[model samples]
Target: MPQSSNVPNGASAAPKAKYNRPKPVVLAVIDGWGVAPHWGGNAVTLAKIPFMNKAMQEFPHTTLQASGEGVGLPPNERGNSEVGHLNIGAGQVVLQYFPSITKAIQDKTFFSNEVILQGINQAKQNGKRVHIIGLVSPGGIHSHIEHLYALLEVAKQQQFTDVCIHAITDGRDTPPFVSQEFLADVTTKTQELGVGSICTVSGRYYSMDRDHRWERVEKSYRAMVEGVGPTAATPEAAVAAAYRDGFSDEFIPPTVIQGPKNTFKPIMDGDTVIFFNFRGDRAREITQALMKPNFEGFDRKKSVSNLYFVGFTYYEEGLPIHVAFRPHNVKKSLSGVISDAGMRQLHVAESEKYAHVTYFFNGGNEQPVKGEDRIVIPSPHVPSFDQVPEMSTVQIADTVIQNINRYDFIVLNFACPDMVGHTGNLRAAIQSCEAVDANLNKIAQAVAQAGGIFAITADHGNVEQMVNPKTGEPDTEHTNNPVPFIVTGNAVVNCQLRSGGILSDVAPTLLHILNIPKPAEMTGSSLLVVQPQVARSAASTL
Candidate 1:
């Protein structure tokens, strides 16, 4: 018989449910959780996981502010993955290396500046080739093409020789399948300078995600250059503004840019890798595959335990629990006998309602940012009557309920809070939060074995605080949420868990708990060493 969180379980593990605590492997991965570790992002979402809840109780617990305090970005800075992971694993605050380099050159200080740039210039000085590779689009979601140009301009001025720039084609962060025109723009600019600047652009394939195509990106650029009306590129302009101010182009006519990919072909060696993407999910599956892949690629250099996975903006959300009971009423009796605290609401759905749930479009907006947001949209509008979420969840619920403890590490991301905030839709954010809360309670109760330790924290903060749209000032956004880090298992008894911490501390802290060595590069200190006081009242509440 299967049991669910909505219905309590009896005194012990299920008849055949096996709770084997898996090996203590380090699960040091970055998530797109800008909302907060404990409340809005994956941190909170993961908290509701019963298995995690029960596990952490036994382990020690603590909290760290990952984004601002731990990572060392500006206090008010948004949590981007690059800094997040670097601080998480690197053990030190490495400023935006590229931008800092540019500033150094502009101020005539490149010759004597920060160690990071000194390192880049040192690579050049040592006759070690410098390979600057990043996304091709000017969109700031990832690396900006203009930033590459800016870097090139500075490099030439500083007379650092033998610099190669390879632009990776991107559509995932910008349009569906965007044109490589920016590639052309960048190369043309490189050649126009004739300062011995070389460029190459790369991509796995060229096609729009679904129906959107490269042509659309090209057309949008054309419109921008021609000073025509706005299209997909309009709202994107704001993002560009956010990252790089003073980039006021009067929409010059499209310049037919061209280039040769061979000039920039990545050699297996000959140069140190400098990946630059300050504001987007820079590396996805490719980063891991390239670093520690079980497979191989053409002319790819594998990492020697020097693998670095970096990025920006991070990620999930769920709906109300609409479940189906497998084996019909046979589990009904089991359901009644096992409910622990009699704390939840459960009912046998009408036979008609018991049918397998079918998932459909909930009219969820996948990519919610606009081109150039002159006026930040507010989230006051109600979901139209027509909008409906998909339904396959019930099937998933059944399977998870029946077989609770199968995998060692389960990483789930809850995103509705972020989504709701992006729309400036506070109500939706609340609904999303409640939905998350419901889902979490069920999960926590389900997986929380008597001796398990669960850690809950956020990647960043989005839904917690709302910045003013018209004024761009800070406002209370969804309670400016602060997430919880809770451990329910035996490990907690000896664990000195407390509060008043940030984000980057989470990874290293977790790593410390797992007994994994924090690489000298990680900037965060382990929470295990610090005495974390249990907060009588949390920083933020829904």
Candidate 2:
């Protein structure tokens, strides 16, 4: 029935267009919601986050471990941004800092056989800047203040020329606004030894109410001065409010974003940067800003180049450390953690085991979030008693939204639940969780609009319960708890799934979703509804 002219030329064929299925990708990460059982931080409590609730109940959700046998920091480390992100990114679990170093410093294992300490001593002998950039805390969580203190003492005894401590801020371990105290103590000890000008740089903190006074930022005074709320009804009140409150955004004098541009100048080259976070996350953000510019936040004369490096304090060394110590079990290795380094002087109490695995990376370049990838954290993260809790809220969002078109893999980490958990302020924690819930909805909507898949999983637990303080109330410590993770979107449809998961499996599952190559390094598995061809039976088996 074809026309004669059309049918003639030896049966012409139609051209076939090349068709390729979209490459699969998996983006898995633990937000602050997953607090260790007994401690604090509840992603769930920050806001009435409808999206998280939906993901938990509607999709392939599961509760994975953050620290303690899961992501592996110490049983006592607690889930943190650094440790969790590293584990998910690399898809593997490894040791961050062995108690071995702490042990040797304590004389539990003498300096005779310790490689790291010996190396430091050797560096000191070279007349190099034997710097120790460590945490000024006693909890033995990140960089132990006492460890640096004792280490500095040793360096002085060995006649090191220049000894410095790039003391960064700390709020997760000790009370907020206590850096000055720690700095004072360090100054006294350094002066006593006359050890290379142990100067205490006023490292910026997330909560700096007043230069170093440990109360909520002077908000009411600012309100009065700026005519904010009822506090500023009259000129007299405003005049009385001149003592600026740095915490609240009422009416204080303007301040610059804390960094080298601030009172502290940018670090110079060959400065021997030493990261001291036993857990990670916080350290990595600054490291990246200092070193590279994934998002636009970095501001320096030149990008971070030039220097010897040490420690898992940043994200570039992407991966999580296994915290193998048993909970409630005394690690037989170290004799007395506190006594070995005089941590009490630094106002910290050291311990071997706890839950809380924080992620730390060399944040010069963050994991880019893009098409098919989503970040699920609490929306509009509410400020705590002071300012916002963790920089993760701003930092993570910037990284995800900025380079969101490059890769299909992504990460979503909601921090409200964890931040609120620490305050033990029940109402605040709940509000924070709700905020995260709302934000999750936004992320899901974005993914759905893009026709992408999104999953929600936590590295540990926090929001479900609250812990009391150590001295005053039954709070302050953490409880052994379980968290949840969920998955959804058009991609993961109609497949049998179970909820069993560990923090190690969070990132690997994403590879399954994207149908991409899985890094053998990961400890987690794909929680997709259907297994890949590799995971399924071969033709002969079928």
Candidate 3:
């Protein structure tokens, strides 16, 4: 969905005299928090978040449609940390990479990609097998079934004798108990191709831990290398057992696929592994395991020796030698413009979502800006986030308060609600909401003490809508509910924000607060406009 467009310099535009009030702005992004009607399934409404609730009533606030085309994603796509932060930092409706990747596969351009071809040909020349691995779902957030099917077709046409697929099932992105539907489609396609095979299967949570939760990574490592995990006669049986045991597809135990001849194929030396996930965070740890010779993050008891590993995109641009496709690379971001305009920026988040605040936020740039300060508090190294639902919330607030006076622009990400929300634990999720509220109070107070403006917004929605209305059960996936954007400071007094705002509107509003001109490339307009006639008349009468 990315288009070729010219970048504009904000310096050339005339600044609005009435809006010219510069102030240091503290932008707080509450991850996976949303505004919704208080209902049975709405955890945010049920939780005690008095500070946030008061802010909504007393401060200037507006609603933001964080998901779908509001943030420049394909319609109906629920917002994730990646797209949400990226749109916020870019200050515009930048196209996402999902549709482009899907288009490339449909057009058969994926097979012709230079890096992809290089990896495949290298394996063929070395007389080795090509192993394709990714999340096996139709979810457009990470990997999709259509993309996987395209890869299978390409491999068959290339006539590669030995091709294996290692799948990571999902219920977090898709609905629970639907792994069999995806597996059935995969099996039918493989049968039609008359080539390739499914090697191993497991849940994404174990294999895709973004933070250095080595314990979870180790379990997946053992499953792939030592073939040491629960097993079933078939993928259908494994999925059925997972549901019977009260687990979703993403939480299912690893299962090695039994071939038609009852042979289990574990990845060994002289194999090329292509990770098909376009999103970076979840794919980073697993990709590193395969690429690094002496990775100590987790123990790979059996060596996965002499492997050619390739990711759909280089997750970390700092380490750029291990990817098959280049990212869309959003240009002229708000961060870059702020840096260019002589403003010092500070980014803070836990390791679980550090990249989202810095990397994805700044058009996928992994390097720290020369004049910027970045702080990454370590996330709890636990198997499940619900165990300590208040993960790093207090520590993050303390860090922000300590450094509140150091920068012109400060961005903070509270990751607790989103992380715990994914676990579908109502109690833990409520605790997470309270923790976030308390920390927000601390941070907002600190910002006020520093005589700075603080704006509160969220990347997406998760805990706000925790239960499925249809089933009346805990729902782990993100919701399409709009989030709240509240701004408080002397600079924003009597500021009128237009309705129908989205995530992209935040950056422009922040720029307006700082008395900076918005760039022409930014499609989103500033919400701070002229006062309404009714409010003006009331003020005059008073």
| Top TM-score prediction, candidate number | 3
**Superposing all C-alpha atoms, what RMSD in Å does each candidate have to the true structure?**
17.0, 15.6, 6.2
Please give the range of 10 consecutive residues that has the lowest summed lDDT in model 1.
355-364
Candidate 3 local lDDT, 359-406, one digit each (tens): 888878876554566778888877678999899989888877876776
Runs of candidate 3 with Cα error greater than 4 angstroms are: 1-23, 243-246, 259-262, 318-322, 532-542
Each model's lDDT comes to 0.35, 0.41, 0.79
lDDT of 1 by residue, 228-297 (tens): 2221122223224322432212111122212332232231333443444543222322332333334242
Candidates 2 and 3 compared by TM-score, better number: 3
- By lDDT rank, best first, the candidates go 3, 2, 1
TM-score of candidate 1 relative to the true fold: 0.42
Winner by lDDT: 3
How do the residues 1-542 of candidate 2 rate in per-residue lDDT, one tens digit apiece? Answer: 10111222232232221221122122333344553333343324434556665565666565666665565555656554445544554455645453545655677443343433554555555444544555566545456676666655665666663655544444444544344456557667676776643322322232122111222222211211122222232222222332334421122222211222112122344444444554443344444443443424322324434444455233335422112121111111000111121111000000000012111211113321111122222233233431443323444434444433333334445554554555556666666566555555665665565556666665445555543344433132233454555666655544435565565565556545543445444445765556565234311121
Return the TM-score for each candidate structure: 0.42, 0.54, 0.90
lDDT of 3 at 502: 86
lDDT of 1 at 309: 19
Clashing pairs in 3: none
